[model samples]
Target chain A: MMTLELYNYWVVIFLMMAGFYMLIASNHLIRKIIGLNIFQTSVFMLYISLGKVAGGTAPIAAEGIDTYSNPLPHVLILTAIVVGISTTSLALALVIRIKESYDTVNEDEILEIDRIADEEGSSA
Target chain B: MINEHLPALQVVVPLLAAPICFMIFNNRLSWLFATLVSWLSFAMAILLVMEVRDGTVLHYEFGGWAPPWGIEYKVDILNSYVLLIVTAIAAAVFPYSWKSIQKEIPKSHHRIYLTAMLLCLAGLLGMTITGDAFNLFVLLEISSLSSYTLISLGRDRRALTASFQYLIMGTIGATFILIGIGLLYALTGTLNMADLASRIPALEGSRTLQAAFAFLILGFGLKLAMFPLHLWLPNAYAYAPSAVSAFIGATATKVAIYALLRFLYTIFGSSFSFDYMQVQWLLMPLAIASILFASMVAIFQDGIKRLLAYSSVAQIGYILLGISLVNVTGLTASLLHMFNHALMKGGLFLALGAIAYRVGSTQVKSIAGIGQAMPYTMAAFVVGALSLIGVPLTVGFISKWYLILATLEKGYWPLTVLIIISSLMAVVYTWRIIETAYFQERPAGAAPVTEAPMSLLIPTWIVIFANLYFGINSSLSTDLASRAAIILSGGSLL
Candidate 1:
């Protein structure tokens, strides 16, 4: 069995790859948003994971307790998660609007329309 | 209380102004309030820069908790320079937005537009002032998200698509940055920039640290629109509302560059970034390539706004080239270019907003013969163009002068010649617009073009005059940029 320390770093890497995969490869607009969510969540996990230490308790004041996980990273990750949620909501809103205007959520179809618009303009 | 509280107030004032903008609900009142707040914040940034100019880093701890444990706002020479640039642009842009927003955005969404602008301002300022790496990511998202909203609000239906594309790319960039920050935290166990600088040397040789550095540079590089990762910038700048384009083009990516600069030298140390990692090897080539690529692409675009958008990418290349030199002169050149480019581009976009307001189109053919009608606006555009082309006695010339000297200092003379040649390319693209505006005669039976309203022209020329003023007497900007460069390269001024 791997030590807890080893597990923490490995888990962070796994989550990172998952997010990158969604961001780079996904086609559906909503799917890409989900990928971004997963990607950001993985960062949260990495930060939280690093804060954990062997034999450390929660970073709260307690009787007869000394060692605790670093609270700073945890605090930072909390703010980051909130920011992630806001960006996700905004992304979803933009997608809804894109769907309404373009009538298709695919990147390539949108590019085709834009290209056609450019061609028509140049021809004019 | 307010003396030490100035840094937080610089951001919090704008943050609070946004919600209040919504509560007022009248578009005109909201615009008035936004302009006032932007000007006030500009004043505060000036005062804060003066306060910190004595080489004292103003460290403000939130809730009375010290740094390395609690989040802190670290105000130093570099951030103050960025603060001045962002707020100065906001102040200059807000007055222009009064009429421009009415013409481009729906009247019903004016409050929304004002709110987004304020939030974007706050986010840019927060990114500049925050002393923590993770905090930098949070502020980066704050600005990026608001910016997406601002861009999508463009009158064009395709604006939504452009904003979505930007959202996708911006999110990926932020994620890469977060991963980089996470890796650093894992190795150093500290998120504060100063603390990380002190602690990272112990983990210098570790693979985790190296990987973290790589991720961080790549991530921030995307945000700053470093050549290959710059896909989001041009389209977003092209499609966004005029006011949005002017502000973000001037400040957003520059703030990201500041974040990159902070991370590279302040947190990771120059020895690690420049020597051990040799980041310049990659950055220098990409920077030179982007200058050529983006400028060439810009020259070919038919849409005037799209042309300026591509030009912004090329300007970013110049800033990066300065940073890639990894020396005092190079850093100073980068920092000064940050201010000068903002003034020039902001002026150009604001002028376009005026033209777009009067003529009702931003296409090159649409604006043909506008120069005879709106000579003042086009003249301002010419001044801005001259700066972009690095003409003598302009801000761009000062920046390029320092950069060429820096390159020659390192015996990279070929790059210096390339710099001059690329600048000639700038003349070509800028002349494209000038020729379209003046030399081309008006088509018969077309609608008569009139000058833009005083509101827009006043702000546009303010930025225009700023270009000339700083170009002539660059002692202030140059001094601050030099101090910032020293602080950055010295590794630990705290």
Candidate 2:
């Protein structure tokens, strides 16, 4: 039982690291958003996993139900999921604007353009 | 009856006003509504500070549910003081935004701009006042999202990239905070901050709890723009619309600092955070580095807004240094600096907005001889700059005086010298602007310019004058800050 309990945490940790790495390593803006989504999803999973109880039913406060999984984490994650969706949509909108202005979604390319522009600005 | 509901109304007024502002298509009407709601919130904040000034804590449970079940709005001396600063700055910024936003942001986006500003204001106030851990995260997202929108409203194309960078970094920070809160909840089975405070001490030896502490600090450090985690701040401040810059520079990071204080002292308890974890060991060095490095960087920036943005980062260092000291005078200094920095930075940014309004740019060279044209605005800028440099008879001076006294109390003489030396660096950077504005010859063939209109100039001067007024008469600010610090540090005044 203890090993199984820890296993869920281990998976959550692995997914979290993978997503964080992708968020940092990717230069493409949309890919970074995907990385953020994955990262947030792992956190959601962690919250849900924390709420689990053996032989527990849904948290409906029904008659004769002595054991129930925690409902609070579920509610918290529900709010978090909404927040995550908003963040993804906003990020995509920003990426669209960046693409329109800089003609690229890659971070390095955008920085290069900005560097050239700053030089021109200072010189002029 | 209304006084009892002040805590809830303080946030709800602005939160509800945001959607109403969104519904109103007219830009001027939306601006007026935001201004009205901000003033209303400020009035509510004042009443709250009065109510809680006698070392009383006001805890309001939502929908009449008790703690650990219902969300709580807890206002003590600490948070009420922060509430006053955040709402007061919003009130000042809204009226100032009218002309500044009109020039810097497109007309079509003006309604959206006001809505985002109000939402950002609401979220910040909510974050400061809430005692529920998860509610704080949700409010953090609200402010961060709206602010990203507000920053991208700047006419300059770089604003887009700046907002994107901030969104990425801020989302990571928020997620880290969520992970930390989840860990705490899993361990303690409670989300009410007061209840968590009581519970966290028993679980102090657990590795999971330790990791939660680390995550919370890192999360808020990023949000507070602590030293190395501050890469996203300067660009965001420099590229955001002038009004957005003023509002966020004054309030957003300050509220984050409030959150840091709340968690470290209120929830985790000062003994565990300061003595056991020895957070000062990590925070003090980073604070020193931020002060020295950011001040040096500020000296080299050509854009006035970027220069001030870097200066804002350095000022955050001063506040962090105060917190690291972990004593009554030190925490008092940190709290006082929060209020003082808001005034000086808010005024400085508003002055820059005025310059941007007439001169069409805030580049150092572009504003050459602006002193001769916009005398009042530049004068306000000069007063704000003097305060930034910690000159006597200014709010900056009071903060540095207490900070120096705090270092001395800790028997850290070298840090006292370092504080003085950094203020000298501030002198150099601020003098650069003064010289360029007043002494440098206006370039030939430049369009004739005049002082910024009364609408813009008045709000800028209000903050500038407040800096001087509070500096000369320190009783009000010092009294509240010291009481709050005593509560936070659990130490008596020396």
Candidate 3:
């Protein structure tokens, strides 16, 4: 019988795998980006869950708190959240440019166009 | 003040200079500022190497909080060597950019170009120096994001597409790395590499630890462009701006390789990573495949840039082969090849940049007879090509010799033979370029060829000269690489 924490971790792992699978399987680049977000958010939840203490309060040094959640994981997750945002923004920007150039967001179509371009380039 | 702050200043000075370069707002001023910033970083790297040569490690605590509290900038023979390679390539490329960028990039975009170049330098340097795992990922993003911008800024429409592809792949790589770090932190309750190293041993047999290792290797494998996972690389290199190609071809993947080493040896114990888990079993076959497959691909590339791009994949194979051997000598070979690959690949890309500057295209057909007119540039290419083929008296040869010796030491005889055959494949691809450049007749009505400007030629020669110099007198590189290798093999040695 796994503990609650172990169950949380397993759920997170499942979510991560589902996200990765969607990233690989999706034709739409935006959907791929969405998958990446899901993947990252699951990891974020894992981190936050690990930081919880049995009788802990919020990790702020306010009036008369005897116990608190480990502040380190919270602080680390803040940085992770910032990184995730940057990645999402960058992926969005790439998708926009990709759509402009290929007039499509589908991976198979873009790859086909690129392949045709290469063939035309060599034969010419 | 800056003298004592070599470790941080190596990254900071360039990072701050990028915005200042933009603020200058004039093309000439921007170019000058960018060049000065690159030289400043190079000088700082040299000083860091001098300070650490005595084997004393410098650990700079950020905000005066020591390890396990605040971030740290750590430097030893390993990262100092990488710092030198990154900055040295930047130093060489900055001057070359003046002539090359004028031809390839729009005059209006000069400020952005200079700013992006400086940012890329800062990111690579920061990634090399940081001792914290999360800090490493942040710097990795900084460099990876800036590099995508630099690549897309190229004139070709496909440049935009190439940059997009790289962004997708690079994002995946970065996310994987972050997940791995997150897992390690969750398991060990810390993000510092040194602290994690101490904590990891007690949990060696844990499934979480094993998963963390798996994620780290896979994530970094994408970043390093390890053999089967290298699909994103050749096109990215082939389509990026020439100067961008040269700088990244030299530095980006090498920094990833360094990060892999930091995690594998420093954070994860060598006994667990190499011996117990046997990562070599996976690394060995993949490295061999990359060498043969990428080289075979290179032999058929019509464009010089794409040829070198495939060749970069092959070169990465040699580095991994060195690493997979899992001994001090093998590690030395890996480290030495990191430097050696940077010089030769940088030189090759710069040579192609010069031709691209002159002929307006990198298609080999365009440059057939131009070699006669651009003799100095072609000569540099020949020297670079010789280095790439690993001929004696070239830096590439020295690294390959060490790699072969390392394999033999491990009693991998078939592997030794494979290494030799790959070098022969290298010979074929290099000879193809040399034959096309010098022997074949120029296509009719080709433009009257003039040599690449002295600015580009001088910097390209700096690497070419280093290649031969290191090839003959390899003691400096060998000493540092071997020492770093020993440190990586186990903390027990120290």
Candidate 4:
């Protein structure tokens, strides 16, 4: 009943959790970035869906238009979208550098490598 | 003509100059330009503080469209103090980086470092100055992104992983904040924080506001590295370039704390957050845990930067502890510690950077007999350590005095004992480094290190001197902190 009544919110929550789960569960750094993207996208959708007004058209002045979906949330989402894209790109760039240095992108492998490095650094 | 636009220019000048700084391409020129820009912003922050000294709020409407319609840049005593901290750190760190980054970062990346520094400064100032909620998010990301870049500039490969982890955590935190702001907007149909402040009172017991408040605090908790969410911080601060460690150690988290204060006090109102929501109950426990937990961890850290990084978490706990007390004195202590932390942490990290410059490493073992090697830098480190321990006639002592006073006023005797115990923990951690550097003999075959260059020493001392000066003569800091605290508590400063 809840899902059917508030389907859009359910969709957002579901996507958010899945993305969050993947972000924590993934071993690959790139996958983590992908998960982060999915997570961000869900938030964007939440804003966009909530801005919609029933029976409303685009928020532009017209002779017949009495109601219009709020344009402000859409504007806000646009900015958020830009932020998301930049985060993704920057994260991927970090992963690339990480892969170059550590010779692997698997989280455990990189961590192991760093551990080894720390051990060697201390012992030397 | 310029007075009205000062608030906007406070952020705009550095933001616009960041790209141009990168274009300069020459190393020293880039450093000089960035330093000049930081000083300019610092001066503007000082000016803003002076203007708001009488407790008047300066509102700058973007394009003259007014609040609720266009973006607004608002300056009050609370945020002006934050702006001063952010810009003052940037001013000092930029000059210090002139020499430090040359040694720590590659020549090719020098321009990028300066550019990122300016961008981060602009972002922190913008987040503090803006009256709009969404604008704060945008600016927060701007600062967060640049800081990630800054952290990754360290010569060590571990810096890459540290920066990567920070980016992931920071992005998640920011997205949570965005979702919270969207919820607030959905509830109130506006994004202006001042407007939201007015409308929020009418929506009492609204579950949506409750949800918004929950998301906002959780996100800010992560951003401010409140206790358990602090995993990303120590490594991020530890592996970053020395100048970066100093710059971020001083200002980044302090600004985040300021943002939290704004949301907790101004937008939500202390009554709503404290009385109705009982947020202090939640915050107080976390603050206590961070102090004891992080201080304990600091004692075990082998790396000096990592030690201080853990201590930063403990210091953050002190600020939050003050906040959780829910009175003007507690709030005053929080603001005072924010300023004092900037001075001490900035100086300590700069001193550590100097040690790293000479010793080529900052491991506790690596710095054996370092006091004799680099007398001035070690002396500066000792002073910073003393301040960190809340020794008498230090900034840390003054803030802790106020915090203890605040707790006592609330009949929290146990909390006083806990504060003293935590300060003892600080003593233990700092004593480890001092004993290693001064008391121990230099291992055989070790090269004799000279004192850090005058350039590094001077900037380091600037903050060190400020830390000592502000500690002895606390009138200025106390006045600003109390006035800011009063405003935050919904009281008229006048």
lDDT of each: 0.89, 0.94, 0.88, 0.93
Q: Look at candidate 4 and give me any clashing residue pairs.
A: none
> lDDT by residue for model 1 over B196-309, one digit each (tens)?
999987777899899998888888888888998888887788888999999999999899999999988889889898899999999999999999999999989988889998
lDDT of 2: 0.94
Query: For all the predictions, what are the DockQ values?
Result: 0.73, 0.89, 0.55, 0.89
Cα RMSDs, all models: 2.0, 1.2, 1.8, 0.9
Winner on DockQ between 1 and 4 is 4
- TM-score for predicted model 4 compared with the true structure: 0.99
Clash pairs for candidate 1 = none
Which consecutive 10 residues in model 4 chain B have the weakest lDDT in total?
B485-494
| Tens-digit lDDT string for candidate 2 (B372-413) | 889999999999999999999999999999999999999999
lDDT agreement of model 4 with the native? 0.93
Judged by DockQ relative to the true structure, which candidate is superior, 1 or 2? 2
Top-lDDT candidate index:
2
Off by over 4 Å in 3: A1-7, B491-494
Looking at model 3, give its docking quality level. Answer: medium
Per-residue alpha-carbon lDDT of candidate 3 for residues B199-235, written as tens digits (9 for 90 to 100)? 9889878888888889899999999999889988988
